[model samples]
Target chain A: MHEQDTEGVKIGLEVHCQLTSLATKLFCSSPSDYRGKPPNTNICPVCIGTPGSLPVLNRKAVTHAAMIALALNFKIPERMLFFRKNYFYPDMAKNFQITQYDRAGGVPFATDGHITLDSGKRIRIGRMQLEEDPAKLSYDGTIESSTQTFVDYNRAGITLVEIVTDPDFESPREAREFLNKLSSILEHLSVSDLNLEGSVRCDANISMAGGRRVEVKNISSFKEVERALNFEITRQRSLTSKGIKVMQETRHWDEIRRITISLRLKEEEQDYRYFPEADLVPVTLTKQFVQDVKKGMPEMPEERAKRFQKDYHLSGETAQILVREKALADFFEEAAKHSKDARQLGSWLAVDLQAYLNEYGKSLEELKLTPKHFAEMANMVSSGEVSRGAAKTAFVEMLKTGRMPRSISEEKGLKVISDTGFVESLIDKIFSENPQAVQDALKDPKAVNFLLGQIMRATKGRVDPAVANRLVRERLAAAKGSK
Target chain B: MTKKQRQEQFISEKEVEHLAELAKLELSKKEFTKLRGELNEILGYFRLIDEVDTENVSPTYHVQDIVNVLRDDTPTPQQPDMLLEDAPQKKDRFIKAPKMI
Candidate 1:
């Protein structure tokens, strides 16, 4: 798992996360909640850039941006300005994007932050800028073969906080880990639901030591981010080994082709001649504003995970898994309130419940399984009313029909039979019906296991195996003496 | 005047051409040459503003002193096809443009 002379892999990320939690678009009063809305419905005069239209900065977008910065431990500046990033794309209805460029007079919203992964490798955040998103482009065919392109303005002018990180990642896996931790932190802050389509997008810049940088864009998911960077690393290594200088360029990740393709050479670069946006006003956050946002911030993932270990006595790994998702962690806390044993509850949730969720490729929110029902199921197992196996089957039943565990158990008759008299009588009946098993038991004591299995099958996996085994042993001994 | 100082205040024809290309604006050769002089004159007037002797004046980014200008997080209700109807060319509720690169 080692390589020579290719160790100088430097990777940086410019991640754009939409502030979908906001109510309206970034600079306009149009609704920002336009994920599945009809195309062009959410566009307003300000967003559509009609003549004489001016942008009024949405205050909530700035607050969410500040919250994200605070969560990342960024240095929040007092005064932040937006600059027009000039570019030519059909999707950019305004012809220039209103973004933040750190200049002599203007500053980004936040800067100089760091996030440490579980392995304690810290990635330095260069800066965070609050900007407006451009309209989405849908092509009739692939970009290389498309005859026409269509634009959907519904996503136009949405607020996005672009987080730029210093070139600190050494491997693609580390980059993926940083993104996962970052996504988890963002989710914990309720800034944006990263589950939504296009909520978070990343552009990665990768290079080797003394080599030109290649930027890979259009990485649609976290998985693809790792893949693109890995591809770039191998591609760069091969190029360097051949003594060919790597050219500085922008490449697009062909997700369909699973390869990186050069989109524009350095010579064809779009000089985004940035200038301070005159239409929008500068946002000046007071010391009190930053402090207020910090005060209102919820407990972040690392802190919550530590608290889970200390307070609930959960193992570090289990606590980390539970707190990875905000909703799942919340569900665990709610379920812990009803269940008596935290350790047992945590094990079931972390193992069986997680397995079920993974099997269906679903998040906790996607399932109708509530904390109340989950707690009830856990308590039943703790109280010995249901075996662990039966409870798991009941859980699958709960998921398939959205029924409570109790009802599912009752409906499917999977309840554990603890009645000693009922169990003994069932064993007697099994001995009589399978008299050959009784005779075999007299010669070989292990033959009585057949009767035990029959009792279990008759109870439909409800009978505890230990109880069935003991009763079958006693009944077989009596029947053997009579024979 | 020296070339450096002259170029500092005047927008050269080459700079004008670069700006036009960046802005994705098509300009004829005659218009490009004529517009350079016009723009440079306007820039000369702007360079005059740099002559103000405000030794320690804090730069103002916006004319208004408002710090926090935010609207409550709420989605504004609007008709679905209202904006699409305004587009000169549209297909299936999307604004049609030439082939995108």
Candidate 2:
């Protein structure tokens, strides 16, 4: 569909994408990838703003920020500036967040107007900026003194792409669809990884009747965003209906409770003290750079969707499910390369594999088995060596022991019996024993069909139905004339 | 264009205060009054956008650039213990604290 066809509702979104740089802090060269490491160990005198550790900007981080702005059709400043956004928080060892204020560290996002979507629907652009992320909060065990909070700077000081949208969304669902589209674009760009720890965070400002918009904070998931906005809208609407006003404040999404609770009052626009950064020079996207980035951009979601349909012959639903996570899509393609039937590959990944993952609340990437192993299983089922039902059992075994599909099938002896001679012998005994079926077989084709049903039932679902039917017909025809 | 449009486009100070309360923010009356005009102006701007023939416009939630950037199946570290060292309380490798005291 053309991007122009999608303008039915007033919706807007603010997207924050994290850049997982190898460097810890944007200004302080601590360490960026903080997985499974001691927290304070990852910190440094500079990151904590110790008196003499002067801050130096990570040039790579600045470039990443600029790249995102350019992709969004924002005007990049020739010079970049950094600002100390004053806020009190324990997560910030410095007690204040150093971020790119108004025009993000000289790479301020000066989005003049609208961004056109693949749907051809144009949503007005607000501003995009770069900022250093704050350390994440580690909640203690108990709410009331049961636990204490901790800070992990692993996420702190990493560069972030903050894109604000004009208030263009009218409903919760639109906001959801828009977020999905954004995640796809960021995935295609390789700039942000949503599945990472605390990588993408969302805040929604919802209002109606020109009433005050209460900004919902720290909604990390798209599902949570949908729920929070819906609840907040109802909360706001009821308040307004009952002569209550919608205050401009911040609220938290209690994901556990599925409710938005008040956190703090809304800050004034001046409260953020958004000023241009002074230290860095503004960056200008040369016509050359924009072209280069555009060239580097992989086929977008829509294009990839079409390609999956064309290349893999996947149903629209199957392709969409695989593409939801780039890793899953890669897994499907990699495994399909080894498989004989692409449809079986798709079904295994989209339906059967996902069913198991859901039971465990995991994803395919989290499994231990490789794509080669997965395809082997798919191949076995498609070749009719094992029933699709039996293939699931073999798959579990593969996951458990990393065994080959053939060996797992042998160990369980779940192979189907398709020999026509063996089945024809069984059919002869059955026809002589059931005199009633023989008499009816000569009387009516429909009654003869009932005897075939009995033969299949006798095999315990091990025999192939088509082979059994063919034998039953030949055996029954000869017996009728001989009698 | 009509009374509905004018009424729909305006934001009131009282409503701002209510929204602030829902957000759990303690706003000064002064800020509440000023936000009304600013809110309306912003609303007015949105109204201008609402008028644009967006019948074909697609809303972009994310600026497309990044695709799934994932780590290898290697397990990343969880939060470190030192972070919790300064916690108000601790109990057997977990955070412990007083009851709302």
Candidate 3:
């Protein structure tokens, strides 16, 4: 987006990264593992909002939020209040979402990051606040399939932090990068698994100022975010130009139409009729409390990426790849930390090793691999005993068979035949076996090439191609001298 | 004091019913009528405890315990070899349904 002298476009994104904390949910002490438990099994009063039963707030959720807020450089409110954001939807067992609005009560922060857009412009961040989440509903496109209309309330109360940024993002690409960076940071803090379904949600609000702000809701994935925002921007621009008033409203992205359909007129605070949550007590934080919470942070991703590059001597791409997911990055470093060839170790983790892990539908912990195992595999590839392709084949078999890399190479007879004595003996047998090919090798100017081909064919490709060529050339020169 | 506290403490039939409607709960007239007293008793407790000089009591919402409540994360559990054959919709390795809304 070229910065023009026209009406400026401001985009503030509200992102939610579900903190997959300690496995229990936000309001109740129920396991938040949605896939593990049968549907309706994880439901409890707090999530289903059973009357007469009060919510005993989850302290870890708050601490996790505080850890994130401090990381984002926001002031902890003297009092944090949860208000019932009144709305009704089948997905929400509780008609009202118990959310934190201005109830964060006057906390001010302005963070500026250079958001590099696909069009090559940088957008800034306004501020990012922390918030809770609602349960998810799957659309089976049925009016009523009493059975298929399912709601998994397990995710109802997971601790989530929302990072809101300024509309400095001119294009959708920049918005995606911002989300990627933010999610990476959250993962580094061990706050979430980036792959967890509905773990992170991005809502991109776009406007071309002749029109009103068109807020696109619950853009499920990052790819959808780009398409939805681009579509909305175009739609609003077209509508405003036609003299149709672009009414301020919240719109849902119809993924099927790839268009935005207005859900309801965007209501001001006066509509929900804001009120304090009478059931829950207000939260207050002190200077000392802030200091204490700051100490509990997990390692931030950016700093770790820099160290991985500098200390491990890995390339920027490799470091970024490893650090994108915290566990894999940690695994790479732990295994390769004491090794001599950090570069080789880094590539194995960033490349072939990653592909192997992906094929298993597993992360680092699922397979029996450590940094020591990775280094051992790297050392085999770096040595000339086994070829790169052979080493990869060996690596997979080693993972499956739990055999040592060298042992696997030996068992498979993959060792390269670099020994000159062995090559000469194989060459002598090949020349005697094929006299016509030998005469062709002696007579043709490219005769040595024919001789080398026979040598390689006889060796079953175990001999290094380069070494075979040299040995054949030497023997051909010796035969000419005798002639 | 928040309007929530004021309303919960003082008792309001209107807001209570609204909350019930939000929760999709069907409460009888007796349950709704008697709910005000019970909520008052509950909110009343927070009202008194609010005065405790928790000046230093960092409201502990989650205790600081680090336990990994995780699984090896395998595929969805095995399907019954013979999915109740009398079921409504069955397709190739899938169950079909009527035209979804």
The C-alpha TM-scores of every prediction are 0.78, 0.63, 0.58
- For residue A297, give model 2's deviation from the true position in Å: 4.6
Q: DockQ of each model against the real complex?
A: 0.50, 0.05, 0.04
Q: Rank the candidate models, highest DockQ first.
A: 1, 2, 3
Predictions in order: chain A TM-score: 0.78, 0.72, 0.65
Error of 3 at A440 (Å): 29
- Tens-digit lDDT track of model 1 for A1-483: 233343899999999999878888888888887778778888887788777888888877888888889889899988888899888786678788888998746699998999987788899999999888899888876667889988898888999999999999988888988887888889998889888998989999999977898999999877689888888888888888899999988899988888899874544446887888877767779999898988988899989989999988999988988887788889999999988877778887888878887777887777777788778888877777887777778887777777878888777777789899999888768877988877887789787777777876787678887787777777666766776
Residue A157 accuracy (lDDT) in model 1: 91
Positional deviation of residue B88's Cα in model 1 after best superposition, in angstroms: 2.9
Model 2: per-residue lDDT, tens digit, A374-477? Answer: 78888887788876765777888776677888898888877777887788777878887898887887778778677777765676555676677777777767
Model 2: per-residue Cα lDDT at residue A348: 85
Give the whole-model CA lDDT for all candidates, comma-separated.
Answer: 0.83, 0.66, 0.65
Q: Mind listing the fnat for each candidate?
A: 0.74, 0.06, 0.03
Query: Judged by TM-score, which candidate is best?
Result: 1
* Residue A437's lDDT in candidate 1: 76
Assess candidate 1 and give its TM-score to the true structure.
Answer: 0.78
Which regions in candidate 1 have their CA more than 4 angstroms from the true location?
A1-6, A241-244, A351-483, B1-9, B64-66, B75-86
